[model samples]
Target: MRIRSDGLAARSFDAETVVLDLEKSQYLTLNETGSLLYELLRQERTMDELVDAVVAEYNVDRVIAMRDVEAFVGSLREHGLLTGSDVLA
Candidate 1:
């Protein structure tokens, strides 16, 4: 459960989605749920906490939220948007 902030920029659109530009090198388009999850990631929440947050915010099952968050986090890491450490520092 690592989150990196370096070379990553995010913008919310219509309060319905989030557009994340990573390293000015690639982009990730997230829906309402993803946007919410991203916001929580910014706060450096743990994996369990993140899953709980997602479940509370959306009408999805815990299993589904956990899977989705895992996938999303993987993608963010692959894009170098997340560094396995506090990115703000």
Candidate 2:
């Protein structure tokens, strides 16, 4: 899934990312891996694709990467930051 086009603004600072949810008037911060994933989430991506990216970038195991990606996407969804058919509820 991709980031929502409306009511969300983000900036990257080195390995970190900060997101502002205008609709919710809340701020979210992302760590290094999350920042990378956030950039990829600018475009549509599948769960597998996201996991693959985490694995490739961090050299983490597939299972751990999948788990982390799931959690990250969950956080984004909870904050209404993602928009796409592939986005999980």
**Which model scores highest in lDDT?**
2
Error of 1 at 54 (Å): 1.1
Per model, how many backbone clashes are there?
Answer: 0, 0
Which candidate should be chosen as best, given TM-score against the real structure?
2
Model 1, 1-89: lDDT tens digits are 44465666677876555455654666778777777777777766677777788888887899998888788777767766664543212
Model 2 agreement with the true structure over 1-89: per-residue lDDT tens digits: 78988988888898899999888899999999989899998888898899888898889999999889999889888888887766433
User: Could you tell me every candidate's TM-score relative to the true structure?
Assistant: 0.75, 0.92
The stretch of ten residues in a row with the least summed lDDT in candidate 1 is 80-89
Question: How many residue pairs in model 2 have overlapping backbones?
Answer: 0
Residue-level error in angstroms, candidate 2, position 29: 0.6
